[model samples]
Target: MESMNESNLTALAAFNHNEALTKIPTFLFLVLLTPFGIIGNAGVIYVYGCRLKKTNLQHFITLLAVFDIVCCLVAFPLKMVELWLPVMYPSGNLCKVQNSIICFTCVASALTLLIISVDRYKKVCRPTQSQMTLCHAKILFSVITVISLIYSVTAAFIYDRRSIPLDSDGYLVGYTCVMDFNSVVTQGYFLALFVVLVIVLGTMLVLYCLVWKEAKKHFMQSDLRYRHSENQEDGEDHTSPHKRNLHRTNRTVVLISLLFAISFVPSLLVSVLFAQFTHVQFSMTTRTIRELIYGTWALNSSMNPLVYGFCNENFRTEFQNLRIPFGCYGRYPAPKKNDIKSIAQV
Candidate 1:
């Protein structure tokens, strides 16, 4: 009789109304965020990929937009469904699959950003380094995509569909997706993720600093020369095209990096905290804050197009001319007859 009672306890767990209620606002935020993110990333894709004649850098940005669109269109929507109406989620591997897609997009997006940083570093810091032509960009992009996919496989395989009973009778009344954080294999995966992020961000930061220092020195010298010249020609533009392009590209990269760091780093740190410290407990407020952080992170995708518009004059002009539901290519002003490669690397 005692053995049967122990088995029953293992099979059944009560669903908590209070916890579900606590998640209400998070679900609501996701509901409102999903549509905007989809539209924003879609606009970015169509504008950058189709309307503009893409440079190698533009091609990279377009790919980033594609990943962000996937996040908005598929990953987060599935997550929202899971949170809002979990009963609708079929049992078995479906939940794991859903998480895999979400995690994949996140990893891909980060890797894409890492690529962008490397591209910029090469262009700005070593102008004579062989330029990344469209072909090279394609190869690099493909390599990173494959790497990110491989990294994301752990997320797919780590989780299992679990059923918990809601009462003492051992009746399974609820199902969930669960991963064992305590398991060595799962923690290894988490460690890999944490370490990769740290390495990528650190390298990006170092490269950015070097680029910025070079740019600042160049600018200061230019200013000094201007000041020394008493009779400078009013119409003369002394700044070289190469330098101007470098400056503009650096500005864009820095802005995007700052935006990404601000939006995602907090949530990522919190996640690391939870994973590393099993004894740590979260209160209702802490969970709520976590949801808000995640929502803001999702909202980051919507904000990228705006960043492009704010930083790139050409993008703004082309976006202005975009026709709703019409496939008109915008006027991109490079020498290429059909595909205008941007002068500045993104």
Candidate 2:
């Protein structure tokens, strides 16, 4: 009996050793990514919201950065806490709050991207129609905030701390945050979330396709006009500045949406599997995989600034201007009036 008890102790120790190993990499990655996300998103807010002339596109970008910052500031830390002490944390309320806020930020980000797509579609595909105004944009942003809050509340109610068996012998069980997969309501909730994601993605894809078709036709016309005027002596550029700005804005939003889709879909899929398959028991390996998947989603929030820097000239220029306070302010000049006018036209 003593020898059997000793063997159980040895196995439990091994289980813990493996569990820690699995979580460490994800934990460290989040720890490193969090500060960069916070600082980068903050810079985005500063430059677009304050430094640049206020345009609708700038407003959308600023708000999106705000949502991303919440993910980095609130969600990432909660996730790191879960990873660092998965077994010892006992507050169900804290778990619920953590998961709920994470859901809110994610839903808000997705909806913002959808709105950007619609804006692009209207400008490019239906140029003669009435376009979205600043007042309308504000109203829509308020609506998005309310809807995200209401949708995310469900997560707070669904999740709770439960015992996750850590050893095959069932000698060690770790208390972790999760929902009961056996519950019909939980399965339905996940299914609904998945449906929403698919619909949002599908709608964006269709809208972008139509916008691209129209843009191609318009650009071809512009190219022909440019070629026709090339031999003239006036030396005026035939391309419309407003149209050029709109195209650049479209490309930037598309890149951001792609990043979100790539990171978010896999995390949501893993979650749906957990809810749909009741027999899907938690193991250290599976937990590690889930954490890594979530890390990708968190990484998405950090990455948008990089996308902005790469794709948008205005954003890139302002980002350089940010370095000026350290005795380099004279190196980069403020955006010209014509640049601001072009953005305003979009």
Evaluated against the true structure, the overall lDDT of model 1 is: 0.68
Taking all chains together, each candidate's TM-score versus the true structure is: 0.79, 0.84
| Inter-residue clash pairs, candidate 1 | 12-165, 13-165
For 151-256, candidate 2 gives per-residue lDDT tens digits of: 7888887888887777667766667777777787677777777787787889899999898788878887775566576754456565655457657777888888
**Alpha-carbon local distance difference test for all models:** 0.68, 0.77
* Candidate 2 structure, TM-score to reference: 0.84
lDDT of 1 by residue, 193-231 (tens): 777778877888998998898777767676556545644
For residue 148, give model 2's deviation from the true position in Å: 0.6
The reply for model 2, stretches above 4 Å from the true place, is 1-17, 165-171, 227-243, 276-290, 323-336, 342-346
